[model samples]
Target chain A: MFELLGIPPQALFGQVLLGLINGSFYAVLSLGLAVIFGLLNIINFAHGALYMMGAFVSWMLLTYLGIPFWFALVISPLVVGALGMVIERTMLRPLHELDHLYSLLLTFGLTLVITGVFQNFYGVSGKPYPIPAALTGVMNLGFMFLPIYRGFIIVMAVIVCFATWFLIEKTRLGSYLRAATENPEMVSAFGINVPLLVTLTYGFGVALSAFAGVLAAPVYSVNPVMGNDLIIVVFAVIVIGGMGSIMGAIIGGFSLGLVEGLTKVFYPEASTTIIFIIMALVLLFKPSGIFGREV
Target chain B: MTHTIEKSQADTPGPETQAMLEVQGLNGWYGESHVLHDVNLTVNKGEVVTLLGRNGAGKTTTLKAIMGLLKSRSGSIRFNGTELIDLPARDIARLGIGYVPDDRGIFGSLSVLENLLLPPKVADGGFDLPAIYELFPNLEERLDSYGNKLSGGEQQMLSIARILRTGALFVLMDEPTEGLAPVIIHQIGHTVRRLKKAGFTILLVEQNFHFARELADRHYIVQEGKVVDQFRNDEIADNLEKIQGYLGI
Candidate 1:
């Protein structure tokens, strides 16, 4: 294998591949956030907590119930999504008439409660979730040994993102969601139940976060603190992508993940702060975000 | 078309009759500040009733209250003999009351066609897309354009068209011609005339007295959140002074 600029090709390509995988998660999570924010007008601060819950739920299913990873994968998101619906109906619905900040605060409080409860029960230690037996293999390319699971993750994320984009951009239900986001009263006047739609939209978005959480559970430890740090990164991604667009969320997430990964390769110390720095730059130059439209 | 004539003939009543839409002692508050107080009015089927007032005269608030957008304090709103005071905005809408806010409630991010498609078919009566296109020809041309990208007149037309897609029998339109060019205002006036001809009941709120006078068969002037005066179409000319005094026009 030839070395470029004294760096081995394998190492460079491997980091790039890893960056792309991380980007996949970012894209999926931020896409969910954008969808939720577009309709709910609420920055779901509890998104990370919900993500953690998704992972924990899967872990619980496997450990206590003796459920297989395959079943847990499908069932955990639904469980978390149901929980999201209940939260939306009970808590978020009451704050609909209030300021946008109130919804944000309420979601933040919810995140704290969820995270605290999970931590109190599970402790701060990370729990290992075994990779499904079928996915426990590596495919060696000419340059690098690629984990089959990571590749599966990237493909699944892409499919999910595209499916969501189609649902929102091309479908009638999506039309109603977009319309409701713009003028809820007007949509309600059309005999479409706007409140029910709001709750469902919130649940869908939370389910997306949970989906990402379940996908990450095998890669990362199922920890109570799993969502906290990832969410901060996602916020930066959203700021860069702009909340006004669904595609922007996807692109912003992946691009920033790749950028962060590259930063780790070239300058490891800057990796942590690079996303925030990019966010500040985007805000300074384009406050609406790279893809965001002005309200 | 035959039914329209029958409905009009049936609508003729003596001095007192049951109203199609009735608001009595209606009061509304935004937070703590009372915006509408003791507002009373009635709309008969096949009527073009205009609510005339100056800025901040609670004209728009009355429409919102009817649509259940505001918190009703002490009032009775009966739309087609159903109490609307405690109902949600969606329920009021399902009752065949279409509300067009003063802002022209267009979904800016959505295309004009998408905006039209946003409102679900109300009461299992299918929406006639061609009928709406016939009403607003400009909307037909700019079907792919985003609501925000439309001209003020186009946005207004789309707003009205959006509501019409719901097949609502009663429409409460707030300032459809506000800030529009004269040509667009003429178009809206024409649309209102067409709507009235089609046997649609309308409660229009407008600041332009001239426009209101042209479209309205009956008028209710509001001052300080109360109905101050009422006039028949024939009495409007005679009551211009009173209208000017109240509206400052």
Candidate 2:
């Protein structure tokens, strides 16, 4: 059946699978943005820079230190997390009393500086990170060949996203975090150390972005510019999800990712612009977003 | 100044008791606009002092300054014998001074229980959730409801309950009855009486002469960012003319 309307099962299934994988990253990254914004009340424009750092750090470990993929996967997030904490304590803390827009500008400046420094050192060339030896093969189904690495990426993203969700929504520390975000002065009055909570929240958000970078390194070419375009897309996701709620971020990320993937198959030219268009529509129709409460 | 005494009462003791909080030459500014000028005040332990002032009389600014939430140009604020100038708002809060702003800084996104849980346990001790529930039984029914969803009265109760949870020895409440229903105001009055009976010191900022007369053991009339008049509880009946002139009550 060579009918245009009846697209082949293989093409449809492949696009759907691809959508699900892209959705995974969207979920994790947007979740991070939501969590950070809730407590710190600043959009972390440097999140994209941190994600690129994670990929670069992992690549450096492999090329120079001869460290394996497994170690880089685990250690890069911690290294980037430490860096995030330093940025928070030094750059962000001083600007807390000023308008929140200033912090956003500071982070945007940091992103430029980091991206520039990395580009100066590494150049624009995309470096290949070999798929881990164990995950190199493809699994053959009757209809398609599924890459094991791709499958692993989706699974790992889901697990990380769920774990982060559980930590923020279910734990006592998360409860304290929610409380602090609501009314920090009141929280402090109760004898809870609120500054520490804000710092840790910022660090955790950065760590989430770094973790996404490590996951992306082996799947895509490890490049200095990897996060440059992704950050814009993630921002759109956050806008559509609402800045206040964590779960909204995850759901918005994956759903939009899937929509983008589907558009790529049917209308390739619209794929890039679709998320922004969706964001504008959401802003016009439901300003608070799908899950966001009107503040 | 305009003051009203619904019922003439006897004068209480003078300010010679051990002062819990002392402000000397306290001047505050908001972006170059001087709001509190050489404002001096004293609150002894377990005293209910009412600050009477009209809008822009610096009543709210004084409370904010005491909590270290404002920039002090020149002032010495001592809380329980400790120097308070230059302390962060959070640190000042930890010193057992609970501030309830006129806006009633409610964490609208959080639930009633979550709002109660926000304040860190102060030296007086953290909030006993059960005790708060006892004070405002309506809150117990809406424990899981978001703060903004609560009614005006409920939010006021939640604000007070949140501060009480901090176990603060002293409370600075600004217009706690503003925009509240009469019944809610009566309930707050009862709550204040209960709080006073429990030995907590209070500095209340109010425009309502009736409410102030009922709660205040002493009164200070503020105008042009300075204390212009002072009176004992018994003096309220005699000071009605001054209160009306300044406060337009």
Q: Give the clashing residue pairs of candidate 1, or none.
A: none
Please write out the lDDT profile of model 2 over residues A1-295, one tens digit for every residue: 2424567767866887788788888888888889999899999999888999988888899999999889988888888988999999999999999999999999999998998998999898988888889899999876777889888888888888888888876666787888788767656645567898888899889888888888888887888889889899998999999985787888888899899988877888998999999999999998988888786
Measured against the native two-chain assembly using Cα atoms, what DockQ does each of the candidate structures obtain, in the order listed?
0.62, 0.33
What are the TM-scores, per candidate, against the unseen true structure?
Answer: 0.92, 0.89
Q: How much of the real interface does each model capture, measured as fnat?
A: 0.82, 0.47
User: By summed lDDT, which 10 consecutive residues of candidate 2 chain A come out lowest?
Assistant: A1-10
Q: What C-alpha RMSD does candidate 2 show over the true interface residues after superposing them? A: 2.6
Candidate 2: stretches off by over 4 Å: A1-5, A93-105, A133-146, A169-195, A293-295, B1-17, B124-127
- Evaluated on chain B only, what is the TM-score of candidate 1? 0.91
The 10-residue segment of model 1 chain B with minimum total lDDT is B1-10
TM-score of chain A of each: 0.97, 0.96
**Model 2 Cα shift for residue A179 (angstroms):** 5.0
